[model samples]
Target: MGFGSYDESEQDNQEYDTDFEDEDGLDAEENAHEGDIEYEFTASNDELLDRLEDIKDNQNT
Candidate 1:
């Protein structure tokens, strides 16, 4: 056994308790979501571009 050498028989066996009885306390069936998402944007392309330009211009000041 030198600097970085390790004996195989010296290491202990590791066992983990992988049993997580609903971690975060939310059941899979209860957290299930079914819905239709709709997004409505009131700003036009020109307006959005203008706002973005304003943001960039303000960042320089």
Candidate 2:
């Protein structure tokens, strides 16, 4: 019964609340977006590959 102590008998007498339903938050369609996205990247394939290699080399140290 001291501070930070554990009791096996107290564990058997405990009741846990299992209710976990909440309708006031987080709807499935709240962030739905319907649109066509278009973009153009000016970086060439070789430039992007060199940058990625540089990042990998930096992380190895």
Candidate 3:
């Protein structure tokens, strides 16, 4: 006997629709933002290289 009385097929469909409707889809769209905000991050070449090295070392260890 099953643990609960609810049907499995109906539950699966409800969960599927909820997942699709809730997705933001920002990353998937070609031009999702359309220039709402401007963001920038700048650093010297040496500083960028140092950060890269730190990341590599962390991954190796």
In order, candidate lDDTs are: 0.86, 0.92, 0.75
User: How do the candidates rank by lDDT, highest first?
Assistant: 2, 1, 3
- Displacement of the residue 3 alpha carbon in candidate 1, Å: 31
Q: Candidate 3 lDDT, tens digit per residue, 1-61?
A: 4776777688657633455543555556665666577757698889989999999999999
Candidate with more favorable, higher TM-score: 1 or 2: 2
lDDT of 1 by residue, 1-61 (tens): 8999998776766567777785746677877879988989999999999999999999999
C-alpha TM-score for every candidate? 0.41, 0.74, 0.39
- What's the true lDDT of residue 44 in model 2? 98
Highest TM-score scorer: 2
- Report per-prediction Cα RMSD to one decimal: 5.9, 2.2, 7.7
Clashes of 2: 0
Question: Residue 1 of model 3: what lDDT?
Answer: 44
How many clashes does each candidate structure show, in the order listed? 0, 0, 0
Worst 10 residues of 1 by lDDT: 19-28
